[model samples]
Target chain A: MEEQEKPTKVVDARGSFCPGPLMELIKAYKSAKTNDVISLYSTDTGTKKDAAAWINKSGNQLIGVFDREGYYEIVMKKTK
Target chain B: MVTNILILGDGAAGTIMANKLRFLTHREDAEITVIGNSKYHYFKPDGIHIPLGIKNYRDSVKNPKFLFNYGINYVRDSVTRIDVDNRNVSTQSGKNYTYDYLVIATGDRLVPEEIENFDREAHHFYTLEGSLELKEKLSGFNGGKIVIGPSSIPYQCPPAPYEFAFQLDRYLRRRGIRDKTELHYIFPLNRVFTMENVSNYVQKLFDEKDIIYHTLFNLESIDAQKKTVSSLEGEDQKYDFLILVPPHKGQQVITESGLAGDQGYIAVDRHHLNYGDYDNVFVVGDATDLPISKAGATAHFQSEYLSGRIASEISGFVAEELYDGSVACTTVTGDEKAFTLYFSYTRPPRALFQSKADYLLKWTSADTYFSGMLRGVM
Candidate 1:
């Protein structure tokens, strides 16, 4: 994980819900220039599936999904 | 332009939001107005103690005018119509109020009439009137089979019905009729609660307390004369006394205003709380169609975040902070013991160890509610 450049924007949505984390990620994505990296922190059990689906459907590059202590992290890059 | 903020329903959510927004935004920049169905602010968590006779209806009630911050306009009027398209509301008092932004905190209502012959025999703790009635009935109760549980899902204060059962077990024991009385609890969910760990923890307590409970039991009809309760699963349970948490629905004014999506709840963006297709309109607390418990703490957290958003946006700053959906609920286990469950939209509730401190905290919450929490300073 330390081998790559850090995310341009990190959205801390640890206690947020399904569409909440996804919406925050999209907000970051919308403002970021093309190729800007965005990472989202969430603890919602349903967010992993929804975020992954959104990253794929929205034509964004899904870098990785990592499980953290009491929460999870999803990293993506704006392509379109 | 001055932001004319109109908050509908001055419950836990609306009151906190009104006060917080007023504190954050200048009075000259934002005119914060709250319209309420009742002038009294109710401490609903203390409602569990009412049926058990620990607290009375007067103990949980407070005047809204006393709680509202200075410079906040409070209208003690019933809303007849919400003309959202025109950005104004018409009340039953023959007055119209206009707003530049709308915040809907008009909470849900218990609908016992939705079930067949349910309310006539059932005694619930959700309402002040019902709790008072239940208290009277409990005083005359000798000993019999008592059924306690919610009639439907998404009811406010998810842990309350469970708390009542635990408290009821103790109440019967205190009356020296524990051996003669039978306590049974039925939940519509596959488990006792929505969360797995909390449900498992509560299930163990029920076992230790010798309280019988049934899962996946969706109530269908009640025959008060025959003392039989029918379920959608084709099961029947006979009871001498019934205590059912009536099904809940959002405010009727929301549905009549054409702003509701399902069960009279307003549909809004999950993160921003923006009403469907209107960024200027937002929803907080039990009124929103969010998959969260409609508890006081849920409204408190939402109000905290929502006030910031509205205030920041009005102050011409980018509103960045979003609601995390944090909710805190306390379940009282009899014998002066209770446990508080703290979780959010993204997080699942963890196991709660019953403690006397939590019981004290739970009881003291009513006091803190009026002094700090509702003030939006705590």
Candidate 2:
């Protein structure tokens, strides 16, 4: 198995619907850097909770989540 | 190295068999090859949800590498010819492969143009491209009269047409356009579902959802230029959106190879799923002209039994009895609630009486089951 890395980036999940953003997030986290910042921009209303739950379960750090222009921007850090 | 097993089709049957074959065999010489055209293995049951805006195409599609994770060799190629007499198969890339045992699971093809002007206006979501196109069409329009219907019988996913209607009702309502949109379901079947109990449950759902149902309905043609669908009843209905489920037939390669019957489906025993004349060849999923609905659960259950029979044939041991043709399915009724059903030839399918949370957990956990099943095979 390869060593895991933290994600230091923000993903624009805006305009993408459910499972779309999450799928992209999963794919993104595959090559992330440890303790790096990963942000998700989603226009779907459900992402705020979905991303939060995902962040918690994956043992990642939630930096901040905010609403802007009818979209939610969630930031996380790879903290393993 | 008793035999070289070749399985065609990357969908449910072939994928499951390849993994199961690896699990059931102890010999290192046994080789299994899976050939198909698609690189993305879709949970086809989710295809219907695309047009309803319930799920996107990406969520339903998994890379073919997912199969590789099961330790199955994946060949992304199209089969052009099968010479059963020569015990060889040819691909479009001019590669010829031979097998001691063959499982044909290429499934079915949809002919949308069978209905006049169908390709011009009516959209089908059975294929990946069709589903993506339908998603675009549905996402843009918030209000319109929408109609969904089947082009012919014996199509894949019997409950999909009704589910499409029900989900669309929910989607439109969520968009605040339900008042502007009139939802109607038209099918050639006498009832919404083949199983009496399922039909009763769905009929009650339709009543509650305010969706119209037309039974024994046949579509004659669509004047795409005029945006109207004409039925056998001689009534021409106008629609802002027309979702079409096209007529399905077996793959042309199987038909050309003379392996398929008049309807292009291979003839197989209901219990064993083996080719009637050729014992070494087996058919499962949509490729077999089975009497049951072409749902994913049928393929899963059939795979479990077929794999055992194939193993016994290889080991010269007596395998268990064949499949009883059992199927289980869940119908999404919007609002995060769904109805699960189990059906068999002996009895009608009724609600499984399970809550949606339990169902979703199991449904999402299917990958775990598949992984474990494949590990046993690998």
Candidate 3:
């Protein structure tokens, strides 16, 4: 039988500001270990773009991006 | 019918007054001259967010040239002397200009080195560069012991230090380092805020976040080389990163000019917004030693009220009215909700109006409107 990896942490940042949501995501990613996954949800209009930018520059893996009811749910996996 | 209106400082209040003069008054006789050293008006409300590495310096600045469309004459020079008896203000450039109605808008000054580490290791985010420097340092931060504390009272935006800590906690957690950073908040106040309800709310948030709090302790000094802050209680705190909110005072020019109160703030009547000594001079914003938090919203409310008084006095339109001392702020709760509170009293040292919102739409909209108006792009 193959061992399964435990899922990492998730950050919900829905209804935050440009930097507010981004800052929450960053804090979550920092406490997470390499290969750990962190989820972020945001209702701010700027979060989707800012999170994508931060992930690209910082080498974090994009697990998924979803939009629900004009809100964003971005899942990123920590990659050191 | 030409009346000379002399405005000092060229900050938020002064700029607003100048704009109001241009917009509301269409009389050809009004000549407005604003005496300020800086060619740009700084949007200081954004200063708090600067150190968190969120707001840029450029975002705080707008061209002074935009005042031209508002019919304001801008004089870019430091005020050297304000002669109330002569009704004249002298500038650093050796020019003396007289005023029919003098509006003193010289804002608050940061009392540098009020605590040990203020200018040394701990950085303040009240100015554009100060905020930028703080931002640069904060962005590269991985995780460690972080301490945010206010040295004393009467500082601009009393809730800023509190706000910074809350936001930082959320910021660090998002980056997966929340557990790595041990955050502490130290305030000398007996309560989080003077207002009972607001203080309770703030205290609740601090408790919920597990941010350590040291209340009623005075900040003595900072030993930068030691990277420690010694409290007046003889306790030393070690912090990898320190954000210090220094005590604020009135500008030296106001004190030197003998126009300020014993506390170095311009003394004004709570009702008419007039100088207690000289009726011709009007003081507004942080320059006045009012028992209220020095924030942009207060200045806006003050300006809106003061403009009417100025019109009544100069245009002989209406009787003098009193300032309600109403003010409020939006407490941004970590990319989720921005809490709004309003407070003011009917008497002196009064907290008159308080309102709270869970969004920043009104704040941001106001910022955009003011910025556009200042740049003549509105």
Candidate 4:
């Protein structure tokens, strides 16, 4: 990842359950400025699939989904 | 020879078992039939959210018929009797079903009438209708004492009353009536929760929230006209609004069918979910006297083990897995935060503190889990 692609804010939602991580990401996105990248780290299995789907459906730009050791991270940019 | 399996009830337990059975058995090897009183499956846990206006009643309902895609027969009928001696069960419509094996998953029955004046005065959030009514009542409330009490123990979802109290506290604060409304939680047990760690954690939260807690206050009766409730120890308390978790018993059909124990619950071998002497009959969910919290999570865990057992038996092999009575529950404290507990019969429940992530996990996974259970994926 390039320095400019780095998230403005990183939400650590590890040890939380599914929608918990996604909800945090949405909250961060709501408070974020346009073009500001936000990354959510979650251990919940459903976060990767559900959050990606939600971001795509809401017309946000999903940078990438990464599977790290023991957690998954979803990066998104607040386009609107 | 084709094995005939008849399952009672179409709630969480019955539906999951039906879908799993369909997946495990060959079409020509077994015939699976499920009989339930209602056409729609209501996620009972979500009823608590209804009164708080977090979700609507319609969102919690799903057609049970939609779950029967794998050639399993779904019958919408009330069970009247189960002649275990003859291995036949009768329905209210005079339909008789004889089976080589039977699964009893009929859930608990709410009996508010057992308490005097409760039927007339106390409001509850257990049923779909009651939740909707409570939602309307809560919206118009301005101030006064709000009492949430459980009429008896062994109720479904052990954490519900406490969760309701927490959510109610949050609700009143949101409505800008927090100072005017006094929140009280009355429990039958000596502590807030049966599990020690959970009780201690919740007690701290309760104290921080300034919610009054009354312990060992088993409900005796309610005076609707006076807006008061009396405890078994002759203690009386007044309330402007009452949210009662009414007394629950095994479905009448289980007792009427002469398959229930003295406490009106099916007596099953705790580990195997089988009744002694009735080799072919098994019980699960709220219907069994399993000495565990009668919640959907318990049923889900039971299904995980029981499904394999039934499948092995049907395949002419001895079933091996033993259920550990594991239970997992997520308690929504308020709109933004929630907590979860996971435990088993032999272990104390481990508590996960309140977080927005936990809340979202519960909110998002509920629907997917429901659909997955219906499709026999989980």
Taking the candidates in order, what DockQ does each have? Answer: 0.02, 0.01, 0.01, 0.01
- lDDT for B286 in candidate 3 is 89
Task: Say which docking band candidate 1 falls in.
Answer: incorrect
TM-score for each of the candidates: 0.82, 0.76, 0.76, 0.80
- Please give the lDDT score at residue A28 for candidate 2: 65
True contacts kept of 4: 0.00
Global fold similarity of model 3 (TM-score): 0.76
CA-lDDT, candidates in order = 0.84, 0.73, 0.72, 0.81
Per-residue lDDT for B1-378 in model 2, tens only?
557889999877777777777777754646788898776777666665666666656666777656643446678889999988788999999999999888898888888756678887888778888888888888888777788888766788877787677667878888899998888888654566655567777888888888888764557678867888875434567888888798778888988999876558886888788886777778888898776777666777788888788787778888669688788777766555677777665556744453677447434634543555333342
Error of 3 at A40 (Å): 52
lDDT per residue as tens, model 2, A1-80:
55333336768876654444654565466568776778788886656765676676556778777777878778787776
lDDT of candidate model 1 versus the reference: 0.84
Residue B237 local lDDT, model 2? 74
Which residue runs of candidate 1 sit more than 4 Å off their true CA positions?
A: A1-80
How accurately is candidate 2 docked according to DockQ?
0.01
Instruction: Pick the DockQ winner.
Output: 1
Error of 3 at B204 (Å): 0.5
Q: How is the predicted docking of candidate 2 categorized under the CAPRI scheme?
A: incorrect
